[model samples]
Target: MLTFTNMRRVARRAVLFCLGGMILTACSGKHEGAARYRTNCGICHHGGEGMKGEIPPLIGRIDLIAATAEGRHYLADVLLNGLNGPLDIRGVHYNFSMPSFRNRLSDHEIASILTYLAARGDSARPPVFTAEEIAALRAHPLPPSAVADERRRLDGIHRLP
Candidate 1:
C-alpha cells in the first residue's frame, strides 16, 4: 500500500528522467551535421579555430567565399578536383595541396558537406548547396591545377578583403 504523495513523487521523477533523456537526444541530434562535416573535411579544417587560420578554416569563411557565383563554382571545383599548389586563403598562404575527393565522395555527399560547411561558417545567412548544382559541376570535371587557376580567377573577382 503506497501513499498518494509517494506515487506523485515517483511520477515526477519519471517525468524528469524522461525530460533529461529527451534533452540529451536533442543535443546529440544538433551535432549530426557537425559529425558528417567532421568525417569529410574536418581533418583539414580541424573542426576548431586552433589552426589559427593556417589551414584555411572553413567554419567562418565559406559564406564569404560562396557569396558570388564564381565563388560557389570555385568551391565546388575545389572539392571535385582537389586544389594543388600554393594559395592564399583569408590572407594566409597555405602550400599544402588538397587531394581530389571526386572519386572518394559522391555529388550528393559533396553538396551535404558544402551545406554543412556553409552553415558552420560565420554568416548568419548561409547558402545551401544542392545535389543538382554539384552534379552540374561534376559533369565538367577539371584537373586540380585547373581548379587552382579557377580559384585564382575567382579570388580576383570576389575579393573578400
Candidate 2:
C-alpha cells in the first residue's frame, strides 16, 4: 500500500548513500600507502618527520635523493638490508642502526612506503617505486655498514638532499 512517489524517494536515498560510500572508499585508497608506512616505518621515522636530528626526516630528503636513478636503488637497498653507523643529513649527524625488513615485508610493501614518501614531497614529477624494482634490489643483500658506505658514496656523488 505504498505510493509510487514514496518508493522513488526511498530509491533516491539508497542511491545517494551508495554513492557516498563509494567516494569514501576512493579517498581511503589514496591514503592506503600512508597507513602501510605508519604500521611499518612510523615507529622510528615518525611519519617521515623523524626524531629531530637523530633519525633524519624523509619529507625533503627522500624525494630529493629519489630524483636520481642511483639514489632510488640506494633507498631500496637500505630498506631491504638496513643502514648503520654515523650518517650526516641536512647538516645533522645521526648515528643509529636502522633495522632491516627484507624478511619481514614484501616488495610491494616496501615500494608502497617509498612511493608514499615521494608523493608527499614537493616534486613536479615524483617517482614511483614498483614491486619489481624492490625485488631487484632485494636480490643483493649487504651488511648495515655497507649500506652506510653506499650512502657516503651517494652523498659524495650527488651531495644528497
* Clashes found in each candidate (C-alpha, N, C closer than 3 A): 1, 0
Q: Which residue pairs collide in model 1, if any?
A: 59-121
For model 1, the stretches where C-alpha displacement exceeds 4 angstroms are: 1-33, 48-54
Model 2 agreement with the true structure over 78-148: per-residue lDDT tens digits: 88999999988778888878999999899988988888888889998778899999998898999989999
lDDT of 1 by residue, 30-126 (tens): 4654676678678777773426435666777777788888888888999999988777766677775788888988787787777777776778788
Global CA lDDT of candidate 1, please? 0.77
lDDT of 2: 0.87
TM for every model, in the order presented, reads 0.74, 0.81
Model 1 lowest lDDT segment of ten: 48-57
